[model samples]
Target: AQSVTQPDARVTVSEGASLQLRCKYSYSGTPYLFWYVQYPRQGLQLLLKYYSGDPVVQGVNGFEAEFSKSNSSFHLRKASVHWSDSAVYFCVLSGPNAYKVIFGKGTHLHVLP
Candidate 1:
């Protein structure tokens, strides 16, 4: 079984500041990693995903994530954040079974001006 863990339940960052949201996953075999953001009264939007090839993958809205097999982690990073970027981020893990996936509790991001 695969699972995702977001250690931080909430994170706060200033506008235009760099941000890093930590995410750790546990799986025996190869796993698919994904970062999704949920805005107020909206469905989850895909931020980025890591399936294969490059360890670091770029995503929408200047978001990027790095896959570390050794560390069993897939962390999301943004060079500079905006107040509008404030939302809940979820780290997800999926195995070969695409239908089945595990989601983290989610980290609420508060961007300060």
Candidate 2:
């Protein structure tokens, strides 16, 4: 079985400050990890993904995530956030080559200037 848990339902960050989002998951074997961002009344966009290779992977918009096999966690980090970065961040995962992704509840991020 594969499942994801996002502890924080909402997060607020000041502009130009670093941000870190917590995420934990449970999977049987090699898991596919992904992070997505959704803007107001918009669709989700891919932030990053991790498969088999390196544990740390970078994505667009200055986003990155680290995969841990022992902890079964993939946490997202941003060096500096902007006001436009406010939105919902979701940690998603899929079973080994299942092609079906399961989305977490999501965390709403509010960026203040």
Cα lDDT, all candidates:
0.95, 0.92
lDDT of model 2, residue 106: 97
Clashing pairs in 1: none
Off by over 4 Å in 1: none
Model 2 stretches astray by more than 4 angstroms: 97-100
Across residues 1-113, which tens digit of lDDT does each residue of candidate 2 receive? 67899999999999999999989998887788899999988999999999878899999999999999888899999999999999999999897466667889999999999
Best by TM-score: 1
TM-score of each model, in listed order: 0.96, 0.94
Model 1 lDDT per residue over 11-45, tens place: 99999999999999999888988999999999999
Error of 1 at 50 (Å): 0.6
